[model samples]
Target: MRVLAAMSGGVDSAVAAARAHAAGHDVTGVHLALARNPQTFRTGARGCCTLEDSRDARRAADVIGIPFYVWDMAEQFKADVVDDFVAEYAAGRTPNPCLRCNEKIKFEAVLDRAVALGFDAVVTGHHARLGADGLLRRSVDEGKDQSYVLAVLTREQLDRAVFPLGDSTKARVREEAAERGLAVADKPDSHDICFISDGDTQGFLQRQLGDAPGDIVDGRTGERLGSHNGAYGFTVGQRKGLDLRVPAADGRPRYVLSITPVTNTVTVGPREDLEVGVVTASKVIWHGESTSVECDVQLRAHGEVYPATVTIEGDTLTARLTSPARGVAAGQAIVAYQRSADGDIVLGSATITASAPLATARA
Candidate 1:
């Protein structure tokens, strides 16, 4: 099989490319240039798709003895992932940029191009598995598992996806990179939002959407607690940076409960208000032929899994969790998984539209 290894200048991707080559696949390393003018700071995971990252990926390909190329996908990426992220935030929703990148760019755009160019599959360094049965499953390294983000991949996309590091731990991956004499063996892993390399999400959004001043009111009392430059700066269950002066009746700190973009308002309340047991989602995509299924629901990347009973009808998905979840936000993913003898199988995912309290939903 001919594989296009999506190298990101990290230890995991380097080893993944090396392993794909060792497996006798005709592998070619390709680093995605996501930014027009890349940031090449040696300042420890400053940015993904940096000029330095592309160089490191090329060096890894040299070590692995595979053909390497840098593909410029910056224009498409900015329009799809980055612009969508700003729009979602402006609509007062907490969007996961990484998930969007995987959904729109990596699997959809890259895989489409790979297939068109006669590559059998696009191999990536994501810590998730695609089994021989064509089911997407959790990786062996649970701590480093990335199934939550990859759940957005459709069945057809999963068929052409290869995750070479799914079976190996990150420790073993780094060791393999060192053995292969890859320069990125000791490089720090990128954890921040790649595009928002400065880590000022609020600042970035303000630049894009401009300042829309709004009142931060109490959810229960509807009393203005404070004011914010933009409602998009806050997320459900966020506590700090609120700069609120209101003291709760229980003398506890307040958390963001909701955001009304139409009204330019952010609502705050006690932490208990954040509890939700039922999630209604839209834009649902299932991996298999089943229209409905029972599975555990994962709300965020690397977050706790909650037992859930999921049912789907067209684009509507309803997930009833056994327990309450905190900080359930709109525009976040609700990934469904089934525990079988084979392991945790990623059944499908949807975009959370709304949530209700455990007691309220059951009532």
Candidate 2:
């Protein structure tokens, strides 16, 4: 089978390509140049689209004796992922850029190109399993499972995708890379957004959207506590950097309860106020024709998956968590799963449109 392995200049992708080649499959390495100015973003021996990373991917492809090329997808990436991120935050929603990138760039744009170019499938280093039934499953390595971010992929996309690292743990992957003599085996994982060099999200937003002053209000009393440079700088559940002078009545720490971009007001309350159970999501995407299912829902990546029943109505989805989850924020992707007789299967995901406070915690 002809496969286009998406190499991100990392150990995982390198090993994935190597394994695919060793398995007697025709494999070609492709590095995505997603950033226009690579130097503006920190490479740090991690992250993709760096000049060093592109060189590393080329070297790895040479080591594995495969043809490799760099595809420039910077324009599409900025329009779809980075711009959408700014717009989501400006509209008071917390957007996941990685998920958006997978949906818009990797699976959609790159995969389309690969298929049109006569490749059978597109492979990546995503830590998610694809079953014979054409369903995406959780990775064996739970700690490194990236199935949550990939929950947005459609059935057709899953049909032509391969995740070679799904069955292996991060440690095992590094070991394999070491055995293969790949240089990035010991590189630390990238933390910040690949395009954001200084790790200053606020500065990036300010550069995109002019600074808009706002007021920070107390959630309970609706009294002004402090002023903020911009509402986009704050996120739900954030506590520090608020610079609020209001003293807590019981001396308990406060957390961000909500962000109202229309009024440019950020509300802060006791941490307990962050608990929520009901979430409404829009732009819902189910893998198949199934509309509704009782499954576990994850509000954020690496967050605990909670028991919930997801009901689809038209283009929206309502997830009622069996128990309240803290820091449930709108604009995040809520991934659903179904508990099969054997274990669990991913249902789909939707962008969180709205969230209502739990009944007991309602103001």
1-363, model 1: which lDDT tens digit per residue? Answer: 999999988888889899999999999999999985656455677667888888888999999999999889999999999999999999889999999999999999999999999999999999999888999999999999999999988888988999988888888888888888888899988887888868898999999999899899999888888899999899998999999877777889999999999999999998888999999999887885676666799998888899988999889999988899999999999999989786799989999989998898789
Model 2's number of clashes is 0
Clashing pairs in 2: none
TM-score of 2: 0.96
Distance (Å) between predicted and true CA of 27, model 1? 0.7
Candidate 2 Cα errors over 4 Å, as ranges: 38-43, 288-290, 340-343, 360-363
Predicted candidate 2 versus true structure: per-residue lDDT over 281-336, tens digit per residue: 98887874567777799999888999987889998998888888888788899999
Model 1 ranges with Cα > 4 A deviation? 38-42
What's each prediction's TM-score?
Answer: 0.97, 0.96
Error of 1 at 307 (Å): 0.6
- What overall lDDT goes with each candidate model? 0.90, 0.87
Residue 186 in candidate 1, Cα distance off native in Å: 1.2
Single out the weakest 10-residue window by summed lDDT for candidate 2: 38-47
